[model samples]
Target: MEFSVMLELLFSGLLFTLEIFVVTLVGALPLGVPVALARMSKHKWLAWIARIYISVMRGTPLMLQLMAIMFGPYYLFHLNMGPDWKYWACGIGFIINYAAYFAEIYRSGLQSIARGQHEAAEVLGYTRAQAFTRIVLPQVVKRVLPAIGNEVITLVKDTSLAFVLGIMEMFSQAKALAASQVSMVPYAIAALIYWVFNFIVEMALTRVEKQLAYYHD
Candidate 1:
């Protein structure tokens, strides 16, 4: 392929990669809140279940998780997945894996909060839900933004793991092209794209951090 043709092909794959990244974040971030709350629940059973879940998700390699999600259904239950299951499995795998990490970050932030804050909210006649939404949640978000940013940066690179499902994400596209053309140029281009992607993410997160800086209590 000509250089321009190669770049265009890779760009097309980058779009698929972006879709995975966005879907994972959109699903995982809010999903993590509940997981974090469950992990910290006063009910022992609920906490134990949540703890085991987080442990398993964090302990396993994400590539293996993707493979399991993609094939386990058919292998274990004899239920056939359609062709589109590739995208579905990738999204689920990424969301669940990232949610585990985000949940821990959230747990740390929630625990770092002072007990006095919750008590004060209650004394002020705020309901538990109201206090959490209005007062506690804001502080937790501010505290956890940097940690979340780190995970998000890692997620950008991890998106390449989608290739295991035969999804032609950026890395997969580059690999195929490099093999056919017998040139390392495609891989070099892919690396440049990835670096640019991470740089943009870092800049965006830095801006968000600055915006939340005023919330220091």
Candidate 2:
């Protein structure tokens, strides 16, 4: 009975974890790419702002972000919200935080392409955007997939941080079950859930990287 209860609690928490992971990626990946471009932009102000956002997010603890995002409206503006708002707030916080890191990852990969490739694209009568999307973007995706895979895995674990915001995410559920049952198994079970999920992510990323292994310059 204890084991079954623990499993149920953990499964419930998994939903919240998955919610955070999905929503954050949905919000962040596209945004991160743009932020990367902005950080690498010719304009000083754009780059500066991007750099500062990245610094603040990367410098601060994620725990702090979780706390501030969850409580900021209530404490600062005295506004209360509904259930969906909790996820939205937490998802936005995680997305903004992770997007900065992803943006830097994107910057490095985008810059890794040989300058000659751009020149060749010009020689072939391709416009800058066309060359970037058709010729350069493929290689950039290949190069960044591995790093992005790592971040995705990290994001899986980071989802547990949502519990700090009173989200009843997997970690929170597991912790509650553990305390109530007075058993170590609930925590161990939660760990297994995370490990298995991460294993699946790693495998999927491995397949993606392999499929793009042509190494074209």
Worst 10 residues of 2 by lDDT: 1-10
Cα RMSD to the true fold for all candidates: 1.2, 1.4
* C-alpha local distance difference test of each model: 0.95, 0.90
Alpha-carbon lDDT of model 2: 0.90
Cα error, residue 29 of model 2, in Å, equals: 0.6
Give one digit per residue, the lDDT tens place, for model 2 in 38-100: 999999999999999999999999989877888788899998876677777798899999999
The runs of at least 3 residues in candidate 1 whose Cα sits more than 4 Å from the true structure, single-residue gaps closed, are: none
The sequence of per-residue lDDT tens digits that candidate 1 reaches over residues 26-126 is 99999998999999999999999999999999999999999999999999999999999999999999999999999999999999999999999999999
* Candidate 1 weakest ten by summed lDDT: 208-217
Q: After superposition, how far is residue 187 of candidate 2 from its true place, in Å?
A: 1.0
TM-score of each model, in listed order? 0.96, 0.95
